[model samples]
Target: MPTVALIDYGSGNLRSAAKAVERAAADAGLSMTVTVTADADVVRRADRVILPGVGAFADCGRGLSAVPGMLDALGEAVIRGGRPMLGICVGMQLMATIGREHGDHAGLGWIGGEVLKLTPADPALKIPHMGWNELEIVSDHPVLRNLPAGAHGYFVHSYHFVCANPAHTLARVEYGGPVTAAIGRDNLVGTQFHPEKSQETGLALITNFLTWNP
Candidate 1:
């Protein structure tokens, strides 16, 4: 069975995420063992890694950093080992070089970018870009396989990632403007929405991740 490490850094919707991944694996007919853990050893041995985060960027970054050897373990498994990894919502934002949520907070810097508050062109559009939005697939990636253009995903965030490399951007959504929805670089992928709460669209993405080789 393939092992998946759902890092428990005291943030993110842990239960929902685990359930989603497990279900995706089952739906895809892939035998996968999903472990929601903070253990560095477990993370190091994981075939696939998932980092999910909810709440403020600074708080999530601090919480992830609080874990002893957790970041190092992730680096070993994802960066060095070249294992496939996924980041969701604020988890994805944490992959940026820096986040300016409460203050100037550093991120994982896996993808060269900055997390900034979403500035909608229309004044009426709310701050927190909540509810369902259609995805505009910008690039082709294995994780996006079987997913249609304009697939709807659940989103609840006020900030967005501005990737330094435009080629890394996989998908975008229209709010008041083009808000980044997904990013990808080699084996790393991140989404600014909750796949667990995204219904069929989310399930397709989750399934793809489970079966994706890289």
Candidate 2:
């Protein structure tokens, strides 16, 4: 049985995310433990880690940093440890090198990118782009299985990740401008929107990640 650690930093909708993970695991017919903590050894020993966050990117980054050794634990698990890891919402943005929201700030740099505000080259589009949007899966990754090319998922964010390397981008959503919906490199996977807050397609995505062999 693989244990999935949901890092309980001070941010993120932890309860909702935990329930989503539990439900996803059950739907996949896989038994797993889902808990919130920042214990380094527990994170390293787990089969997977979920870095969930919400609110401002800078505050979220600071919260993660507040936890002693949390980043190093994640590094070990996702890099040297080879345990699968996922980042949700602002958590996903944290994986990038820089975020320009509320002021410029540093990120995890796991992926090369800058998190910038959703632009409106067209005045008709809304800021803080919210509600369900269509996802265009650009690759054949198993984590996206059963999801149509135009699957709709919930989104609520003002800033979006501009991936420096297009190869790392796995999915995209249009909000006046094309924004990265998800990005992945090896064992590290991230989503700019909250799959937990999304409905069926969101559930499917989480389930696939839990059961994914790669």
Candidate 3:
């Protein structure tokens, strides 16, 4: 049994994430407990942390910082304590150095890079990059161990991670052009797609995260 913590900061689809974890755990033959709380102690005690976010990048940044001691707790839990952490959607964007959407804003800096909005040099691609897309895997990471290349996943975001270290990118998806879809470094993993909305493949990804040993 792995206790997965789904962070809540008055943003994004917390309920959906919780349900997805529970459902996936059942399918994975594992026990999972999901909850929404800013309790630093709870976050520190969690086996895996799942950061889910929605809304503007700037707003999510502020919401994360507003959670009292949560920021440090999360940092210590993963960086110092070596607990596994996964970020989804805007949650993924927060792992960057800065987000250039709306205005200049700082990110968690878990990985080098800045978050950038999807803007194609060609006018054919759409803005939000909504719907399903394939993850063109580039590296072998624990979080994506069994996941096949070209796996179709759900996406609903206007921004994506522009990793400074391209090596950190685990998968890339075509959206107007090639965009980062997933990234991983040690115990940290992030997904630009909503795994919760991505069905079986998504569940497998979550299972890998829970079972992976940092």
Candidate 4:
């Protein structure tokens, strides 16, 4: 069975995310171990990794970096090791090159992008784009497989990822204008919305992530 390390670095919806991944594996009849861990050694050896975050970009970034060797382990395991990784919400934002949340903050630089504040064309729209938003599939990626048309993704965040390379964006949601719903590059995939909160659409994504070869 593949061991999936759900990194616990004082951030993210750790338990719920782990449970969701477990449920997805079970539903797909796939045997996978989803362990919530803070140990870098465990992460380095993990077959797969799930990073779930819920906070400001700078705070999440600092929290992740605070864990000794955790950052290196992630780079070793995901970048060099080429293990598949899924970053959720603020977790997804961390993958960007930089985050302009409060000020300019450094990111993992896994994906070529920047985390910017959400700017809906309509001023009446709320700042934190909370609630379910229909995803507009942009690119063909394994992480988005078997998703139905007009599938809605659950989101609750004030900031959104702005991809430097447009091809990195997998799917987008319309909130007055286009908001990035999902991002993918090589073995890394991330979602701005909480897949655990999403029903069928979320389940399908987690299942695909567990079984995704790339």
Clashing pairs in 1: none
**lDDT tens readout by residue for model 4, 1-214:** 7899999989888878888899999999998888999999999999999999999999999999999999999999999999999999999999999999889999999999999999889999998999999998889898997886668999999999999999999999999799999999999999999999998899999999998998
Q: Evaluate model 2: give its lDDT.
A: 0.88
Please give the lDDT score for candidate 3: 0.86
Alpha carbon deviation, residue 79, candidate 4 (Å): 0.3
* Candidate 1 error regions (>4 Å): none
Candidate 4's displacement at residue 127, Å, is: 1.0
lDDT of 2 by residue, 118-167 (tens): 89578888878989988988877777778754678788889999899998
Regions of model 2 farther than 4 Å from truth: none
lDDT of 1 at 147: 83
Which should have the higher lDDT, number 2 or number 4?
4
User: All models: lDDT?
Assistant: 0.93, 0.88, 0.86, 0.93
* Selected candidate, larger lDDT, 1 vs 4: 4
Number of the predicted model whose lDDT against the real structure is largest:
4
lDDT of 1 by residue, 101-158 (tens): 9889999889999999999999999989999998988898988877855699899999
The C-alpha local distance difference test score for the whole of candidate 4 amounts to 0.93
Q: Estimate each model's TM-score.
A: 0.98, 0.96, 0.95, 0.98
